[model samples]
Target: MNLKNKIVTVIGLGNSGVNAANLLSDAGAVVRATDSQDTPATREAQAALEKRNIKVEIGGHTENFIKGSRLIVVSPGVKESSVALQWAKEHHITIISELELGFRFSKGRIIAVTGTNGKSTVTTLIGEILKSGGKDTVVCGNIGNSLCQEIARIKDDTWVVIEVSSFQLERIEKFRPEIALILNITDDHMDRYNNFNDYFSVKSKIFRNQTADDILILNYDAPYLRDLKKKTRSNVIFYSKKEGSSDAYVKDGWVTCVSEGKIRRIARISDIRLKGAHNLENVLASAIAGLRAGVREDSIGRTVKNFIGLEHRFETVDTIDGVEYVDDSKGTTVDSTCRALESCDRPVILIAGGRDKLSDYTVIRGILRERVRQVILIGEAKERIRSSLDGTVESIFADTMPQAVELAGRFAKGGEIVLLSPMCSSFDMFRDYKHRGEVFKEAVKKLKTRRVPI
Candidate 1:
């Protein structure tokens, strides 16, 4: 990773890309960053990096900016089909993700979490558990902070809990974590990958370099991930809601670990604050990682008890006129939205649809029919979603998030749930899932006193 005045090209100029360029420049590399976007944000990023003497290309990438001497580092948002990557491949230049670059310089053992869903929750939980157990910890990566941004804070004793994504895993070369947890792999990011198998293969690369000493925690319910045990040399551990079938599992309302015929209780199911089976799975995975990292059962239990779930993922905004409005804007894939629905306690007036991820909307038809009282669709995927799920339930469309929320208010009645669980990415109508969730909350707030009979 010694750049030492060697030219390094950074493709994409988002937060991670900017951090990568800064990291390379600080490591004494001559860094040049490029992004096709020329927005105000990119210009601001460009201004900040230019002070560090890092060359930045904003409007578009040209051959002059890309024909480099040493290596290429890419941000997760950039496509592998881009001309810059094509050139890198054509010239046989070495390529790696910013995650890989960060790992090359990082000290301490890492706990990396990757899956179609629940990565952020599990990563945060593991970090909390380790810290509570008297271990130095820093949580970074796809849970809003890039590893390069936290390099100065990472120490040799630091337990690095990273929330990794399929995009980040695609270009990793030697980024191996001591504890690698795959929560679950469902069809996701279909827009980026050729198929589900391609996405699955890329995610499996997280443990590709791990030795037998490293541990790979998996979900026993995820059937597709079972074959992964045969693909890796790492020590494998599976977590399940059922008892006795996995290294870590829930038995008789308690979270327990079974190893070498030994059973150790970690936490009671009643102590957990997070709802839903998906979240319970997240807790089980985090507990195993914590115990493996030397966390005591009491410490793990306390952390799990106090750990509230992440925002924009099944967060209850407010109860208006006996209707509960839940925001799950982070459920950006069909599988995630289905999990959210499966966790709901009341009949739902589901608000969904966004930038389509090319997911099969019909896969969710069964859940929609069972749990959802009505479906209010919005954003670019609304029409396609309605088409796929036409006869499953009562369906309608709205052009915006506010409009969708307003419609939900009219259709929802007492003892019913109004859940904003868009099964597609939020690029079509908002900045990100957070913004979409915020808009939905605000819309819900406006309807506190206004209620209509369904």
Candidate 2:
């Protein structure tokens, strides 16, 4: 772990990569960073890194720069197929993920959360529970700031709750969470991976380094995850919606946990503030992690009762002429959108389709036919979604977010819902999911003053 005067190359100059570069330089490494993008953000990052005397290259990568580095640190956004990474692999350079780099420098016990969905919610909630229990906690990784950004502040007793993606787990050598939670695995990031099993295998790496002393919390309900405990060395804790055979389960209308042969009630089903059954699963997983971390049962219950959830995931934007507009722009996969559709009690005018993830659009047909009255398609995968949902619901195309909002308002009647739950990634039309959610919200705000047919 001694980095003094060691050569290191960081791939991708995004938030994680920038932080990784600065951290490496601070650790006395001869840091060299590269990013394929040369946008304003990367330019700013480049200026900051140069000030620290870290050599940086943006707009493209060079094989020579990568070849000279003895070690390579990769940000999650950098693809495995990246030329620099491929070159490093070919040359037998030691490569690791940004998550692994941060883990090596971290002085805290980590509670890492990963899954296709609900990772942010569960990760943040665990931090809240630990904080309420009076534990020093820092929440970072995929949800908020990069883990490397918070590394210097974390102490030996600090509880680091990180939301890890499959990409972050790909290059780990010794990164292991003290408490690991995989919410559930479903169809996601299909384009980045060769197939579904490839994505699933990467996510399983989160616990590959965990030992018998560590805890691995998994969803007992997800068929793909039910038997995953056998693959890990960590002590497995199963959270389930069912009544029996789980460490955390719902029974007699209360969320209960069986710990040390004693049944502890965490919260009532009606007491959870977050909407959706998926969120209930998140709370269950968080509760188990909290108990394992020695968080008081009362603290766990209190946090779940008050946690309303993060923005852009089932957030009620506004009601225009009684037609409620909801923002679920964070739904970036077919499975997540189906869950969103399931959560809606009213008929929906669904705004979907973004950058395609190679998800099978037809899997959402049953939910669309059940709850959705219309589908407004946008982004690169609009035509594919339209074709997949052809017989299930009436589908239309909108050129922009505002147009989509207008079209939904025109077609939606009072008591109906206009839900922005894109079943694909947001990269096609927006900077990220947050940006996509903001645009959807702003469009809804603008539509409030315009009178539409009820």
Candidate 3:
């Protein structure tokens, strides 16, 4: 793992790529960073890399640089079909993800969480539980800060809780976590993957390098994970909302964990602040990981009670004229949007549609027909969504977020909810999900100023 004098090329120049380049440069490796687009963020990242004496190639990628390097580190955003990556493969150059690079140098034991949804919530909760138990914890990856950036801060006793994505998992070689949790995998990232099985295979790699001494937390109810006991050598632990054979499950209104014949109450269902059954699954998974990390049950329970949930994931914007507005911009997949729809108690005027992930929107047809009053569509997938939900629910097309909000507000009745739970990625319009959520909130604020009639 000695990087001194080694030639390294980092692709995509995003946060993770820049961090990887800087890390390699700091370790005396010759680093070259590349990206296709010269965005403001890319420029800032370029400047940082330049300050570290790392070479940067922006606006486009060069295959020669990647092929000639001793190693290539790819950002999660970089696709497998990239010409430079293809060249690197043909040349037999060692290519690894930023996460893998970080793991090679990280001093702490890793707790990695991966799923189509709920990775952030579960990862954050695990970090909180460990911290509450007076353990030094660092939470990173996919959620925001790159693991490579956090590598320098890792100490022997530190607990590194990571939120991993399938994209990052695809390129990992030996990035095995001491504790791995696969919350639940559904049809997601279909645009990137050829099919559902292809996506699942990539995600299942999180357990590939795990040994019998390591632990894997799985969803007992998810059919995909139920029979995966023989897939890895790790000791598998199960968490379920239903009363089933699992390490963690709700029993008599309390979430309990049973490991090695020892039973412990993690938290009461009424104590968790996060809404929805999906969140209950998240809590259960986190609690199991927390307990395995030696966190006290009281510490885990207290963290769950105080955890208010993440932004853009069922966050309440404001109520205007007895109508509630919820921003679930993180609901970028059909399964995630279905969870959001199911969580709402009141009738919904749903604002949905964005860049389609090749998702089957019909999966949520039953919920839409039963609960949603109307579906206001926006972005690239609007027509696809409208077509799939044409007879199931009333659908309207809007060109912008403001228009969508206004239209939803107009149709919303008193005690109704105007929810922005687009079942596709926000890349069709905004920079990402966070920007999309912010714009939706701003639109809601504008509605208040207009005094729009309900």
Candidate 4:
């Protein structure tokens, strides 16, 4: 792990890769970087790396770079099957992620949160609660800034709350956090893994290296977690929305946490700023992590009461005239979109489609038929979504975001919710969910006329 004076090659120039390269260079590592893109798309990033005096190779991975590197830090976006990766493996070079490098230099308690959904909300909320409690804290990883970027800002008392993903977890070694959390896991990122079991295995790595002294928080209701707990050696803390046999749950409107023989009632579900059953579970997880980090009960209660939800994940974009527009663009999977649809009280003109990850949209049909008033499909997955719900709802297809917004607006009544909760990846139309959400906002802004109430 002594990166000093070592020849390290960062295998991508994405955010994580840039951070890794810069951090390694700062630590006196002989850093060299490589990227696949050389067109106008990646020219700026390539220029930035060269400006930093780091050697840059673009257009393709060079064999010399792989042969010359003593260590390789692969970005999450690059799969292990890349020729450069395979070449490094054959030569016995060490390959690690930015997370592993960050973990090496970190000096405080790490509270790592991993799940298919609700991680960003939970991680941010936990950091906020801890900060309100007077703890020096930094929220980093998949949700926020890279850990290396914030290394100089951290103090000994700093509490690190990291939003971890399966891709980041895949390359980690000795990156154990003091408190590890696995929220509900469902069929997600099916494009990355060979199967559901393979994806689950990588997620379970969040607790793989922990000892008995470390705490592993899990959703007792998640069948995946239930099976993984039996395989882990760490001490477990279980939370659930279901009745009985859980460390935490809500009953008669109060959110309660029972650890050993002690019972603690944190807050009421009605008191929470974020709505939906999924968010209530998020609230519980955040409160527990904050409490374990020695955050004050009053601080936890107050933060939960005032916490505004993250953007693009059940975010209320606008309510023009009468129709309400909600941007849940972060609902990249079928389960999340199902939750978003169910969260609405009014009838929904569900805007759902994007790059299909070979995902089955049939799973959410029951909710679509009962809750969604109409379906506005867009992006590459339109036909699949249309075929899945052909007869269940009035479905329309649009090729672009603006057109989709206009079509959805035509069908949206005064009392209905216009929701952009694409149940697939946004790569077909935009950079990511954030980009998709912003474009959706722009499209909604262009609509000046309001439909008369029926």
Q: Which structure among the candidates has the greatest lDDT?
A: 2
Every model's TM-score: 0.98, 0.98, 0.97, 0.96
Candidate ordering by lDDT (highest first): 2, 3, 1, 4
Stretches of candidate 1 above 4 Å error? 259-261, 449-454
Predicted candidate 2 versus true structure: per-residue lDDT over 126-173, tens digit per residue: 999999999999999999899899988999999999999998999999
Error of 4 at 172 (Å): 0.9
lDDT of 3 by residue, 161-213 (tens): 99999999988999989999998899998889999899999999999999999
Clashing residue pairs found in predicted model 4: none
lDDT of 4 by residue, 1-454 (tens): 5778889999888888888888898889999988887866457767887888888888999788889789889888888788989989988999988888888888878999999888999999998999899989999999968887777777777899999999999999889999999997778887778888888888889988899999999987776677776888898887888658677787778777765467777888888989998998998888777777787667788899999999999998778667899999999999899888879899999998999987778889899888998888999989988998878888988888888888888888888899999989999989999999999988887774443343
lDDT of 2 at 111: 96
Candidate 2 minimal-lDDT segment of 10 residues: 445-454
User: In model 3, what are the clashing residue pairs, if there are any?
Assistant: none
TM-score of 1: 0.98
Taken over the whole model, the C-alpha lDDT of each candidate is 0.90, 0.92, 0.91, 0.86
TM-score of model number 4 = 0.96
Q: C-alpha displacement of 243 in model 2, angstroms? A: 1.1
